[model samples]
Target: MPVNPPPAPTLSGDLLTIHRLLQSPAQIQRRLRTIQDMRFIADQVLTQRYRSAGGAVLYEVSEPIFNTRPIEAVSPGSEYPKDVTAEGAAALAAVSKWGQATRLTDERIKRNARPGNELDRVLRKVVNTVIKHIDTITMSAVASAVTATQAAGDDWVASTATILRDIELAVADIEDLQMGYRPDTIVMSNTKYAYLASDEKIANLRQRETRDNPVYGGEVEVIGGLVVVKAPLSVLPSDDVWILDSMQLGGMADEAEVDPGYTVAEMAVQVQSERLARQDGWEVWGRRITVPVIQEPAAGIKITGTNPA
Candidate 1:
């Protein structure tokens, strides 16, 4: 059976104000996830190429095939073998918009109003929600590429004796794929990060001098050649650790004109505002667009069952 559609928003009052905040020139300040570790492909690249090719729906990539034909001793009448290249295509799918809305009641707004910027507080909340949604989507895409061997039973924290061993194993898995990928980054939940930082073996390997500020006081940034990143439990489970050749993980955005791609769009927030005449309040809504894809799944591994000390 088909699912029922959500009821439409009641559009009785005139739109008091509409801020295409995304298209605006003013800088809106808010905390956002650090997504520099991932790669991003622009929609314009795909769209332009598709249009150039008579508006094809799919963008195709062709790779040369080599070393398949064995060289044989030439006979006077023998014919040389022929080799061909392989090709694959990725179709562009519409990334649905994710949005959220909050109603600002008159009483609530008046209670929290400031001298000049009465609406700043409520607007910031809406913007932050949009940013969080983008982060969730990007992280989920990265997590999806995790390999099966790294799951639950092979817990690195549970077996303290094998913590370093597990790290090696995880890196080996990426290298073994022969995809020319090297694991340079490791991300784990805050809990697991604490466990690793306190582990006796891990502490000994830390360099005496520090180049970057520690997440937890005295926590080393690098472990086994991988830069360690502590992620919130909301982004990754406390029991899981992810090792990645970040160059292979990427993000996508829809916009006009073509330029270099970004791992995550520097800006992904847009806002629309409405005045609620009936409730003597206001409504704020926001939306963002992003598509995260792993160009090479072999470059990432996820290990679970880690103890969150």
Candidate 2:
């Protein structure tokens, strides 16, 4: 036996209510969890937890400077030399709950503001809006912390330019630090990605495969052994490219997220609803509390001027 479809909005505001999925906190919580798992540059970084919402977010990095860090030679012996002294260090930054909220008032339904499908669309849109805001903040943090940067000699769009050469330089910069990081991810804006995907030289290098082939399929999934990710212009400038060891880019820290309840404790958008008794409506609220972090600046390289201004 099927349950009857939930009632739609009515002129009698007292009997009208938001669709069940939008009004129930638990249902919205599950929806948020599934959607948050999608790949965003923010999801590529590290993950951490703080005891509280406000205070300094603490992180540790090896004292060896990110660039030009040297590895000491070890001599073959019965016992290895004692560990180097004072190699550990910690840094701190202020972190607080970062979030945004919007209300769904009842007057709109009475005014026939949205069709039933349109009302559901808004429920979905609010979820993305909250998560997208967080993604931008995290990407910005990583961009600012990047100290390893170089300029592409020519815009990747130029037929004579070589993207492989730039990738090699990016990989070399991080490896030279002698930290065991192997850059595995490359990110750029769609416009820059189009240039890379269209380059004949790159296609020639990977034409052996049919799937995701630049020529055979006009799709580019990876280039030069780096997983390619295209980002919005707001997160990545069209002229910039980022190559990084995702495991070392640092991660988010927001203990408040788990405090309310979450077993795995990852940064997930929190959604809740409240009824305005007199107003005859429900206001859906979406928020997340976290901050992105950077532990090894050398683990990532920002290649600038990848395209013409």
Candidate 3:
């Protein structure tokens, strides 16, 4: 916490011009630091992440595809065991940079009757845009990183008989391939999740299994051995449901160095302000250097057409 925070510039009397805000590098940096401390679904779904800039995303194509192997009985004199190599070949995917920058004009700043409040709003939205963009990349990676698709035999929204079965089928779809990954998580839209909560069977189970049901408690717990992630419509703008082993789903590659006590995503952003070379105002720039990659596609399965038609 800052002892004496930067004063909010007023339109009149203590007029705070855009130049004043830009001049305070410490204040601008402090604000960005706090903003960088934020988190999103990309942070959760992409469980593997670290700080590193260059080089390709080296990963296993299929990974350990053999779920079970034959064991041989051996005498004291017999050989110990056979050696086995990991399934799939080594592949490389270049990490691409993703960033966005917004310029602040003095004319625009002057129009803002409440410069202090509006400036804060501007900075928040600017950084959030970049973060959301990163989240979208990861969502797209996982959504497309599936070779198996489980179409609901019955509409999940209306039919109760196959709701749980649908999830298991998606899980098995991945496990049956012997890909050495078991899905323990499911991601869906809030609308679809509401239907799951309203299911009579699920409601009864919640009622009998625990006195403090998630239904009445206003929270969702584990269901059918899978952690439920009801994502926002904007984040998951699809009718398709995803069940995956997040531990093996994908990872993020960061180009910026993370400072101690700060997240890689936070440190990935660099914010600075400089006088407009030709203009009368300052130009505030925000950039994030990071990328998300799906290392193993077989670790996930997509369940399509789960929403009501």
Candidate 4:
């Protein structure tokens, strides 16, 4: 029996199979872009260019008054009303660069059975890191833009009456600003969304829509005419829900031609695999350039204490 030991098991076949699972170059790039697109806050706001002449600082212009006077029928000789005075101001916003990089050793690349696109994985990591940083910055800006906050009590599900009232109040506050803006989007943490989806009141309302309709499946409820969405806890606090006029939020990015520009659309991952004299690995890195600004704070409201027990 000792002399009958079989030959050692070969791993080449398994390795080859695993190599086949590596995605093509196009697939890799598409996946990365898809991930970035999924960032809800980034997709919702307005994005503008930061021109090179703007320098490292950009200004947000504001006009406090648009002087509107009621029109009156003028007598034939009455002097036409004078044009209203124009008052304008700007707030300075400093732009900063954010970047992440990763290196893959030559040996590791050679050992990879799927070798042609070895650097794709490294670039993906860099892209993901940059997107996360952008999201964090945008979320922080949103939190700061909150002009009003309401307490939703311990449970929105149990306190349905209060919840509706609070939502209405939040919407009313935005309307009271008279800024020609309305709250059209409601964002909340995933935990809060789950609770709301399961609440008896919400379920009953959606029952008609979900009846025997595959396309209208799940809870399709709108509160106070605002479309509700679930966001990660990192973006919105688990204990709060935010109602915002998304149009009022502005984001800026620099173009590629701009010096020290930081714009997500212009963001790219650079790869260096050849001409390495000492290093034996491929270097991959990406940068994110952005300035998240609250163009109108009065357009957004945050509701707190909504966490379910």
Tell me, by lDDT, which candidate is best: 3
Q: Provide the RMSD of all predictions against the true structure, rounded to 1 decimal.
A: 12.4, 5.1, 5.3, 7.8
Best by TM-score: 2
Candidate 3: where is the Cα deviation over 4 Å?
1-29, 32-38, 50-55, 65-69, 105-115, 159-161, 176-179, 207-217, 232-237, 257-268, 277-280
Candidate 1 residue lDDT tens string, 1-309: 665795543322111211222223232222122323332112211112112222212333222223556667777888976655455445453454666888766565434323114355566666566655655555676666555446443454554456767888888877877657778788776777767776676656655566442534556678889877766677542347888776554334333222222122345455555667787776766565444444455667877656533
Task: Give per-residue CA lDDT, model 3, range 185-249, as digits (tens).
Answer: 88888887877777776776564656466556666657878888777677664667888888887
Clashing pairs in 1: 39-250, 39-251
Residue clash pairs of candidate 3: none
Each prediction's TM-score versus the true structure: 0.62, 0.77, 0.75, 0.71
User: Residue pairs in steric clash, candidate 2?
Assistant: 46-250, 46-251
- lDDT score of residue 94 within candidate 2: 68
Ranking by TM-score: 2, 3, 4, 1
Enumerate residue pairs that collide in model 4.
262-289
Candidate 1 — which residues are off by over 4 angstroms? 1-83, 89-92, 105-120, 151-154, 209-220, 255-265, 275-281, 307-309
**Worst window of 10 by summed lDDT in candidate 3:** 258-267
Rate residue 98 of model 2 by lDDT: 55
Which ranges of candidate 2 are over 4 A from the true structure? 1-19, 33-39, 46-55, 63-80, 106-120, 208-211, 214-218, 256-267
What would the C-alpha RMSD of candidate 3 be, to one decimal place?
5.3
- Give a tens-digit lDDT track for model 2, residues 124-168: 666567667777877777787787787787878777787888888
